[model samples]
Target: MAANGINSVALPPKDGFASGPLSPGEPAAPGLPLRSPNPLTSKVTSVLSTSYADAEFRDALGLLDERGLANSAETRRQLRLDIQKEVIQSNGDIITEFGRVADQLRRIGTTIDKLNRSYQEMKSHVTAAHKATSSTLDEASNLIAQRQDIEKKQHVLKALREHFVLSEDEEASLTLTSEPVDDRFFAILAKAKKIRTDCEVLLGFEHQTLGLEIMERTSKHLNQAFQKLYRWTQKEFKTLNLENPQINSSVRRALRVLAERPSLFQNCLDFFAEAREQILSDAFYLALTGTSPSGQEDRSVKPIELVAHDTLRYVGDMLAWIHSATVSEREALEILFVSDGNEIAKGIQAGRENDLWRLVTDEADGTPEFDAVKALNELVDRDVSGAARVLRQRVEQVIQTNEDTILAYKLANLLNFYRVTFSKLLGTQSVLLESMSNLETEALRQFRSLMRDHIATLQGEFQHTPSDLGPPDFLQESLKQLTSIMKTYETSLASTGDREADFQPVLAESFDPFISGCENMAKTIKPPSVSVFLINCLLVAKAALAPFDFTQKRVEALQSRVDEHAEKLVASQYAYLRTESGLDTLYDALAPLQATEEDIAKLRTSDALKPDVLIAASQNLDDFLPSALMDAMENLRHLQDSKLTRDITEEATEKFCVDFEHVEEMLISADEAIEQGQTNGHAGSQDGPQSLRALFPRTTGEIRVLLS
Candidate 1:
């Protein structure tokens, strides 16, 4: 039981003693001494001996004894049996332990299942609680929103009752009304009433008027309700002693309605103008005076400067409003212009004479600021040129008569108004130009359609043949007619004037027709003309129509002309080749001919033509076309001499050459091999050379030798 007793002990149990003879104990050894075995070692030894005690073990032991000693065999056998029995018992113990582990695992699984069920129940409760809370929150939010909406409606109703002036009869009528009114209708009625009340307060209604009576009654009630407003305003102004001229002027304007004299109304406007001018002049002085060598305190205020400042501010506002009103309510403005011409004229005259220089320069006798005057002059010149000119002349005359500084300022103010009016006229002119441009675009579209139709008709004429003429003659006539059409297009284009409104459509129609006719004629010809006439006509049309800018429509027409002509030329060339060389039949015979080549070459190689022959035939066909046609093609190519066209043609030609070279090489190689075998002595010999003629004698004999 010592920690390291096994390592310190001897390898074998020596004399069967516990440390050999039990260290002088009382018990004497009988046959062998009892050894104190290490617990771990004894367990291992028992397992090994038990496992080796069977018949299989006996045989192994016998074999070991045969190789060595038989005397020790019995002892070994006994030890092996004991060890084997111990191993069996150990294995049984392991099986029992495993069964206990399995039982424990089952209990754990059962506990886990119960826990999972509880957890699921908890999760369901949590989910339900969350949903309920969310629902409660949503309901609260909805209730709050409803309350807010109600508050807003109440506020609107209160504002309407306080602001709107309704007569006793009208109020009674509203109450008696049984029909249900929507919110939008109520809002509209409220807004209209508010606007009418404001207008009545601002414009001052006559006492005899029904509207005045209602507004007076409403004002009386409002004054009673707002009795503390004056005290509030006084408290607000206490901390700031600055007088707000704008507020004072607004009050004055409202009160002016009570005074019915038109002259008094005019006086009020004059007073407002003077007050506004004073404020503006003060602002200007405040800004510039600090920057001057003379300090801010040195800047002086004058009556003329105040008048000039007010005039400029008023003119600026008037100009802005006029600009907006002209666009939004042009008819209303026109009525105003007719009814209030004298008032407007007088205002303009006063603005022109205003001494703006005194406000800007802070000098009473300073040269009148002509900037506003100049601006007014420019505006008047653009919008109402005649009126502006007359206004300017009158201003100069007035200046000469009154050399009064006030009159000068008034004239300057009037000039500013003229300038604003002129600017509006210029803006109107721009709008007009934009409309004209759109109209031109639409017109051009219509013209293109008309041109395309005419061209289609001309194409028909070129394709159709007369019954009296034979096929060849008919084709020739068609070609002639097409050429004539081209000539007519050229003539029409040449005579068309640059300024003529009808020129574009006429020339487009004429030229487009000729182009289509030429294309159609090409289809009927033996060889395509590839004429430059169509291109020439297009160029001429472009030139004639050049005076009218080269719009998208014209460019499209030109592109169409080029495409049609090119397509027809290619088609005609293909058709001519088919008719002259019977290439169509060759295509059909290709598979059969290939089969025949194999048969003939098998029997006699001499009969089979090489691929070179087919290549030469194709080359000869290409070369056989009329020189006139080639020249025409060259001329047609030259027609695309412009930078844009040159790029297109070069690319097309390069691609065509590459494909043609590939086809030529394939045909040539095949023809050359066949031809060499047929003519050469080495191929003609039966057994001397490999020959297709020998292989396919039947096919070689039937095939006609057409090339030679």
Candidate 2:
């Protein structure tokens, strides 16, 4: 079995046959008795047996033996013959079975193809049907919506007609008067009438052509009634007397009734449309032309009386309606107030106030006019406090409802200027404060009104909550400027020896109400509470400084105490640290430090242990600390200067600047440590001098040589 075909076994000959040929060859070769095989032979036999018995070799040999037996010529020939016969029979059977299988597969494939075709056809049919159905449904829905809208319009028209009580007799008697109704009024009336008629026609068409089973005829009649009422309102306005005291009041009443419960009236649209024009015209004529055509002064009419009466009536009506209406309707009306009515009233009031003041102050001559000026000035001084109180009340009221009103902003701004002016008037001989107060008051009132209107409009349109009202950039700047002016005014007032005590109470009284109002309002606002607090603090500090004499050490000491308190308050309130660097790196590390108790405990034990950690902590408290401290110091310094002979402003400013710079320097050092730690990837860790030097590359080379 070896590849070389070497004989591996050596066997002894059979018994007594060992001699080569036992022949007469040279003395018979010794009969070599068969000797047992050598131990080496046995060993070789065992080795060969073991090697041949290997499973792999044995398997191969067995396979070879089977093949050899199978390939023997006799067996092979017979087997070949038998195999050829068997193969022929088997192939016949295979061919028969294959034909059967192929036929079955063909049938199955054909059936599947038919089913697939049917499924695709059905799916497409369903999809097409669904699309057609959806289209029909959408058309029906649109038609329903249109019908509903038409009905609503008709209903409104009917209500308008009933309210105006338009009759055939009145329509017949209507004619163009000497002072013809303006074309604008007529145009609006015509538009209202046309809208009514259009609704009637549409209703009729819906009934006749569309076969809509509804009360179309009744709706059409209602629309016609509204049209008549609209025409009557126009006629009434054309004949109205602006000079009659009762006329303005009546018109306002009518407008309110119409605006609030339009649904109750049969001709609501006609009434509203006509009334809108009439009210404006009447208001204008009453404002401008006080007398009638007879040339007698209209003794019965006063512009302020007319406007105040009408505006109050209008506001009352609106409020009543707001109370009665559904939440949604009330909201809608409120939006309208913000968008239209409030702004108009504010503008009219401002113009009226300006004109009245101008007339009252006619040329600065020193006779009765001078006396009048002085009296009015004194009156303004007295009334300014009252005005501030009223304004604060109004602001708080508006803020309390979680509602915005243009009136609120207007009031806030007006009060701000009034307070500032009052302080200035009490302090300086220069009329600058007085003039500024007047101008700023006017501006602030206007600004407040505008902001309120804007906020109201936004609230109405977006349904904004109280939290939505943020102090816009303009408002913030306005507030800041106002604060600055007040601060300056108070400083000036404090310096004036004659009126120092007088100004202090006035300033406190004026600002206390405003601060209180703002605080109350802040509950309903967003982040502005912080601003309110800061402003209040500023005002308090200013007021405190106003009465204290600068020359007295007691005043200075009191001021210092106030400053300290302010600084502490700011530090606690802001919870910031004073540092040179910004908080980015410090904050990032502090987050992880907080998660680890060991780090926090370490910080508590050793103040200087984690420079980065401390820096981070300090940064959080820094924002309020410096500003608060500065404000406190400024107040104290002002108090001292008031009592002293020195120029207080210059000294206070210098000290503030120096302290602020020191705060900045401290912040810088903390930031530097944080940055170093960040760069070295071991924030706030204590490192050896060498390691620290390596972390800070600039120090590396010098420190390395020293360490070596």
Candidate 3:
């Protein structure tokens, strides 16, 4: 730098002044100062040290003094002046660039001012354009809303047509003359009904012409469908083969729907029941006559009347045939009635509710309050009514003509058996059951009449009962017949609603008369044998009645009678003991005494009861005591039961012993009276001497041992 700028170090001897600064390490010229005048001045590296802001200053700074030492103050002052000149030159160039930028900024401001005025000119034209299109846009919007509303109304109209109108194919299924009545027919019929109902809702609107038209059309279709169902049901019923005991669901549903028209439904039922009745009546005639209703001989099955030659068998065969037919008929009809009985009830109930159903009903017909079970039972009863009538006639003839009371009861039991059977199959209110019941009552009446006439013959005749105190042969024979009748009744299937009440008349007619005859005969027997005879009769009656539940009270009554006669036997035996054992005289003496017997000491004052008489009676008792019980029992030996005889004997012996004790007490009182007289110095009061221990020597304990 010193070579390029001012050199403070002199060049070698260039006239004693530096033409150039020193190169490299050259010494300074003599007398030249090498020290900087301001030490900080040489320490300065550059005036434009951050030359990156202006790259032009970098070259200019290097051209200035790289002076290392100061020679004089004038030389340092020239270096300061050079640095100040460079700074002033650089500031002038920056000011010159600012002046060019200020010109360009003014030109841009002028351009922005002109564009702002042009935008103001376009604003009014755009607002005028918007104003011109507003009315057209409002009209277009109104047109779009109207178009959407019309499309919505079209959709609503399509839905209404589908809901209120039936297709031709669907209508044909219900109303077409050639269409068969079936499940599909019924389904379309039901749809027509629902549309008719929905039309009612449509009728609520102000303009109801559509509702009225659709309802009229649907009602016509419903009527046609129901008419088809009715004719189909009637046709099916005419050909119904009830042998299988089943009805199809289609036919069952048809019946349920047709029931809404009461006159039509009732007419169909009347025909079915009538056909069944005629068919069964013919079958019964064939069963009876061995010939068909058309007069052909039926060789396949034997005629019931021919096989059953006897009266009871003929009647039983008729009833059995009726029962079998009733079962088959009931089994076939239950599918229509009992199995779906509630459906019949509901159908009638619904018919009563429907105004449309009311229009078809005949006012004179009693069809509104129909009972399904009653209707079924009546129908079945009618079907077998012919057979039931024949059965009643045959059974009544047999029962009424039957002279044998036993056979009459057997017929009664047979009638009751069939009566119960028909009641179970048909019900208690059944006509067949009522006829059988009347027949049963007639048979029982015949039984009772025969029994009464037979009993009357025995009572009116003077036939002697056997001499042996026993039930007569007539009673035994009647009882045997009664037993046979009872066994037949026991096995019979008669209703046991109140068996005791029902059979009590039979007992009274057949049994009570014989018992009364026995009592009459017992009255003619000898007095001692009367109780034994009655006891024997009642015991026999009781044994016969013991095995049956219905005869429990009768058995109890017989037992009570037997016991009553047994009490009489016991009393007779006790009386015999009192007489035979000499205790009767002592009891006679003691009979008049007070209950406490305060006057017993004075009993010896009576001559009949004196001490010697008491000794005589006591002596007689001593003789009787050895075999007292034996003698008492021997008196009642004719009693049928040995146990009863023994029991009567013991009771009598105890009574005898009790009387002996009383006599001994009386004798002791007499002895004490004599002693009191003798101690008071009057010895005459001791009547003829006999001690109490000596007289009446037997004690009650001894008597009990002997009796046992």
Candidate 4:
């Protein structure tokens, strides 16, 4: 032992051990057996063993603390000893626990080895099982994927069947059977049409046979359905009660559906028209004569013939009935034909008018169809044709038998009214419209004939013209008739074209002939009075006609005629004034002398133009001047218009003043020539006054004043 109290030291064995890393839960160093050899090696061993005792000494030294210092030596030593014993005992228990831990670790190692072996064994089984079932699992996955795809395909097929195929009952309702064309029928037809339309999508696919087959089947069904509707509609039309002009919904549906088939629709319209024609014909007879085709319809409403015994009223009532009937018929037809557009089959013949898509594509895969408005017009014309014929005969009969031109004119207006009404309701080329137009034309012809006959009678009766310069009685009566006729034209419904042009013929037939008759009657009136008579007649015509627009040209023409005759009257009045003033003879004598200066020189000494002759003419002028205006006015006193009398008097006076001025100039020239003659001593001394101023003392100024 060392002097410090370490007894022994532990060292490595003489066999020599290697130093390396330790395992888990290992001590810092392992125990080694010790053996003494040389003193040097023994010293290394002693030093090693002494290190263990040094640690114990260090702990024992710590036990000599503050408390330990106060303690007795024995107690302190005993405490150190207890501390060492406890340390040793605790280290022993630790060693014991470590040893038990080592045993458990060894057992755990064995179990782990068993577990790893079991794992090695089961891994091969798992691999083998996986290998065995891999294809089966893959097959199951593929089966699931295939099942999902099959479900999807099944869904698509179900949808396709619903889309492209009509059910059996729906098919039967549309084509196979004779059922009333109702909403159900229209519904089924609409479905069939949709199926056909959706087939276009089918056709877009590579397989188009399905689409083709569906389209073919649908087209056939549509044709058959339309044919049934057409025939049903036509048969229904045989008993169509147009008396109540409201259309039946079923009939309307049938017509709307049938319109999808244009040819069949047209045929149906023709059939309906034929049926209505007969029905309306009988209805017309009932209204006209209070007798049906069987002669047993209600006679409560008296015959139109009885109510309209007057010829104008008779034609008017008939035309009224026709117009009303045409309106009602058109309304019903519009209801039947022009409903809202079909969803599948548009009413387009080949294309919708204003459809922008129509430029790029033909939306209508259907056949050509007649326009609804056109077909409606055709039907209306045919339906009314029979009644129109009856009305025509009656109207022509009245126009022919009735001698009253005014009544005939009224009948013509009535026909024109209905004609225009029919044209609007049907069309301009409707047979009924054309017939009415013809009847109107005939009525006008009859009116003109009656007018001519009356004129002829008047011409035969009044062989001599009126003594007074006034409008003749026949002329006045003709003007009154013309005025009434013009009123009819003013209120007329049908304007052929330009207002002035259309009425030109009327003027030619009526007003022009009146003018001609007046001219013929005025022929017997001698000279001056003829102008006054024409003026009076023309003035009356202008006043009567100026108010109407269509007669504006006639009024203007009358004004021209009036002006013409007025000019003639003024001329005659001027001539009367000239003769009264004795300027007529002077003018005649001056006419030849005006050609040359030598003739002018001769005028002073000429017998016809001598100073004495000119003085005598002046004396006559002086006398005429006092009463010239009165005498001039007296010449036209027979003029019916006092205003016109004043106009003519003033015009005549102006003319006289002009002529007087001319006479004065020539007289002054003659006077100057006379003075020249006197200076040259050709005529020696002039007798009386030499200058015409002194000779014809009455100047043009004085004449104008007197006329004024």
Candidate 5:
């Protein structure tokens, strides 16, 4: 039944199955094979037929057993036949069910055959439809192409029939290439002109593109040209013609030759103006930003300052070479050196910054950027200042080391070195002149400072031992050095034609301290010694200052003061010598001496000035006749016959004479007494008749001794 569900029949093995129709020799149908008989079936059949009566088992049951056994055997036979019938019946049922299955299978096979046929027909139809579609598409494409061709041909034929059809004379006109033979030729010429005009218009478009390309190439060529020119300039100007005496004129002549023909520089001017902005921008960016162009690492390229400076110099030289170059090249160079698209004026502008003038233009008023002379001067200033600074440092070092003396010649040597080096590197006449001027000023300043310090030190030295009034060697030597320096400075200035070489002011200024110092020192000494040494110092100072014309008056003034001091000292000494007490002592001792013999004997033994003492004092006065004070007085009188000393001496002398008159009066009284004695006839005794002459020797001797 399970096999019969799909309409297939199962039969015994003796029968063969068939699906559609069975052939005689073919294997059984695709359905399950027919069932074959097994041994169990046969065993069951045998068991059904078996009986105990057939052998000893039947006898062992006795009569009842025999009867039962016979009955059983019969029953077994019947059962065997029943079993065989049942077997046949089962076979028949199986074959019947198998037939039913075969019929159902046959129907299923027929349906499958029909479905296969339908599938084939459907496939064929699909193929046919695809072919028809492809053919239709091809036909459509071809029709469309043909339609387009037909339209194009129609359009062509229409044009040929209407617009392209030419008259015989028009065709002849087209063939004409030269002078017109007739009206047709003239028409052809007119068309030709029109064609030319059209061609020219078209060419303008072409030229626009081509022109830009040409300009690009030309720009590159110009750059390379400029580069070569710049390199050449660098080489040529490595040492500008500063070595040659006529370098300025030579260069100017050379530039003038170029400037005489301005047309020759037109191309250069155009290129320079066109390229300057870009080049300056590039240089500026590179200098401040350290940037380089794409793919280039030349950030260390030289700055534009030198390029601008050199370019301006070249331009200036050219202009200066031709006096008319200013008027001619002003416009060209204005464009060339323009910054910010604004033209820099020819001269420096008051409102414009100086740095702007660094790229100065030729039209500038005062100092053109191209002025080589001015450039040389500016460079010289830098070099000289640098040299002066270094020389000053060296001089200061020398000053520190050799403070005792001035380094005037050494400074001259340094100045010479600076001049030579400047000339070798950056010299001109103007430069040298200016540099010397600066050198003189610097050297003088430094020397003056050195001298001032020396004088201060000398002043200190004088102040330390004012009584030691002699000029030390160092002092004299310093003065000598100062004189030498002044001379050197003056000579240098004179060589440069400098009219302001007067150094008298410095001399007087430096001497001020010394003069005041002497006076101060003089005041500290005692009177007599003060006069002595101060005079010597004054004379020394006068000698020291004698070289300076400006200091003559000052020296004379010092001499005058010295004389006054001497006279004052003298008067004080004379006053002390002739004091009333002093004269009274003399008078008391000598007044009692009479012309009598006994009084004269007493005067000889008295404490009065003895005759021998008087003689010695007189001799000493003679020795001191031309005293130092007197000499100083005479010297002062010679310097200026001023009455200051004379009045002082006369006043002091009158006081002295008054004191001496008392001594003279005592002598006179003595003389009178002696005379009276004589007159009274008392002269011949041993103690009588001693005259005043016995006590006093010479007439002026006593007065001279009193004065001493």
Candidate 6:
């Protein structure tokens, strides 16, 4: 029945009596007591024995048995059943009590929860009330503070009106005063200063600080008013007459007032800036439309001149005013003046490039025209590099248009003018020099091209004619052209006064092809023809360049080029003269005569000598008969003192001598054979001796072999 699953009672002793009586014949156990006997006692005892695990119930049963509750069997049975029913009833009572206690606890928990939620709600309402009360108090405090501040200001205003009084003179002078124009101005200014000091002292400490601040604000306002008047006066002053000296004094007074204010002095710069802007706009318009100040289109006034004149006038007037006003403003005035001048310069440069370029190219010398260019030069700070660039472009254009030597000469003359005219800048700037250089380069390029073409024509003509000799007409004409071209180039250079200019490099380029052509022609044509062609080229080059002092190196180079080919031709000619027929047939022709004396004698009669032997014998002399060979030999003969020519000539002569010796040996054999016949058979051995030397006809010339 308790929470621990047991009754709240002590256990019975092991010897205690059962809850029932003993049977009639059954005795109680030893040391255990039992007296009562009832019919229900038996059942009670049986229940107690069965439920003995409930020790407390068993103990209570023992007490009841000892108290005579069970005496008979019927009574015991009755008691046993009665006790069993009581036990079940007691258990039911305990379970009912536990359910009642749990219900009570749950209801108490619900009541506590409701009380907690109600307390939270009341706290929230109290907080809102407190916030409203605090807000109301803050508003009341703010209202009180504002009322106090209003009262204080009123009191201060009342005090100021009562005590802050000035004299009539002071009151009148306290207002903003214009600077005086006459001798009384200093007296007025002194009165104004006294009025300001007296009012400042009249106000108390707090009011004095406040009054000082107010006065500062008033002073700034008055300063602004004065500056406004000064600007207006300055604007009007531009058209003011100098004849009215009083107006001049007034203007001077205003300027002095403005100058005294260091803070407001910078405002005058704004006026100057406005003037500069107007000047720039006007200048730009004038540059475009060539319009005068009166709005008429005036071509007589050039844009540059207009810009310069306007700028100078503006600067001069502004500076004169500034200097007349105060010396202290010079530094500031000059800065603005120069800045305005720079703006005007930039505006003048706004002229169209074509227009400017036309001015550069114009040859007219009218006063307006000359002044315009000069003014433009001054407007651009006297730097004409920009115009120089235009001139350079013009030179390039001229070069592009012309190609002939005559045209090139004309272009050179034009460039010469540009050079001399612009020579002042030539050393300082490369534009002119570069322009001249480009002209020279272009002229030389044209010359080289012409020379190449002419050389090509000469080469073509040579190919068509198929001759081993010159002077070809095409070569002659080309040489003449080349000479003319060189002369033209020299003249151009000379006119330009470029004393050190060398045209040889261009000539080298032109002559290089000619040299190569001659070399190639020499390979196929006779050396004499090639020699003659090269000689003409060399002579023409020399003659054309002879007059120029700078052309000596070029002339030497040309000679060297010609000489290179000339040497090769001479060696070739030597080889040509040394060409000998094959001696095989010649040897065979003399073989029979070598075999016997009679064989040699037979040949004298029989024309059995092979024609190759005569041809071979005549080979040395035949090599000299061709014009090319003749030329080669002549050249070699002239140069024989030189080692190379001497060696070549000596070698050629040696070859000729060897060839002749072979023929002479054959002749000696034939003569010996004829003498043998004269001794042996006494025949006609002299049809004048009948020798091989006699076999060679007289017209062929007697061949002598000089043994070396």
Candidate 1 ranges beyond 4 A from true positions: 1-550, 553-557, 574-588, 591-708
Q: How does each model score on lDDT?
A: 0.40, 0.40, 0.74, 0.74, 0.46, 0.49
lDDT comparing candidate 1 with the true structure: 0.40
Tens digits of per-residue lDDT, candidate 4, 1-708, equal 121221111122335542222344554445653333354665566456755446655543454443335556566455555545765787799999999999999999999999999999999999999999999999999999999999999999999888778778777887755666678888888888888888899899999998999999898888888777777787788877665656576776666555555467657766777788887788888999887878686858689998887777888888888887787777776666565463112443333332211112244654333345665677677888888889888877887888888888888877777777777777776788788878888988998898778767776635556778677777788789888988988888746467778878777777777777788878877778999888888998898899988778778888998899888888888789878888888877766556357877666566766677877887887887888888888888889898888888888878777766776787777677657666777565546345667767777777778889
Residue-level lDDT tens digits of model 6 in 604-708: 754435344454554634443334323534654433124545555555545544554555666667667657767888764545443445444322123222211
Could you tell me how far off, in angstroms, the CA of residue 693 lies in candidate 3 after the best superposition? 5.3
lDDT of 3 by residue, 1-708 (tens): 323222322222344644333454566667976744443544353233434454444433444434454657666567656655765777799899999999999999999999998887788787888799899889999999999999999999888777777889888888776888777787777778789989989999999999999999888888887877777887888788888665677777776777777777777677777788888888988998899989999799799878988877888788888889998887777787556656755775676542222323465655565556666777788778877776667677777778998988988899888888778777888778899889988988888889878987887532465667777888888889989988887897655677767678889988998888888877776756888888888888888878888788889989898888887887787788778766676788775664344665557566657557767877886787778777766666666678877776776567766766666666666667656657687655655556555655666677667666
Best by TM-score: 4
Residue pairs in steric clash, candidate 4? 9-49, 10-49
TM-score of 2: 0.18
Q: Runs in model 5 with CA error above 4 Å? A: 1-252, 257-404, 408-510, 547-550, 573-708
- Candidate 5's residue-wise lDDT over 1-708, tens digit each? 222211221122234433233344655545765422454565466467757555333433343333343445456455445445756787899999999999999999999999999999999999999987997889999999999999999998775343323344543444422322334433443443334334444346745653344345334433333333333323333444333333333222222222222332223333333343333334334432345544354645653333434422322222122222222223233222332233222212322322222322343465333443343233333323332333334334443444323463446434544444444444455333454446545655665676677766666566653324454444456566656654544444232332233444555545555656666766775656566555555666666656654445666787787677667656665644444223435645664554556764465455555555554544554454435246435423422224544554555555555655656655665567557666678656557535545545434444444333
Clash totals, every prediction: 59, 37, 0, 2, 13, 30
Error of 2 at 193 (Å): 21
Ranking of all candidate structures by their TM-score, best first? 4, 3, 5, 6, 1, 2
Give the TM-score (vs. native) of candidate 5.
0.33
Instruction: Estimate, for each residue in 508-542, the C-alpha lDDT of model 1 and write its tens digit.
Output: 44444554554555455333333344444455444
Q: Output the TM-score of candidate 1.
A: 0.24
| Model 2 residue 18 distance off true place after TM-score fit, in angstroms | 99
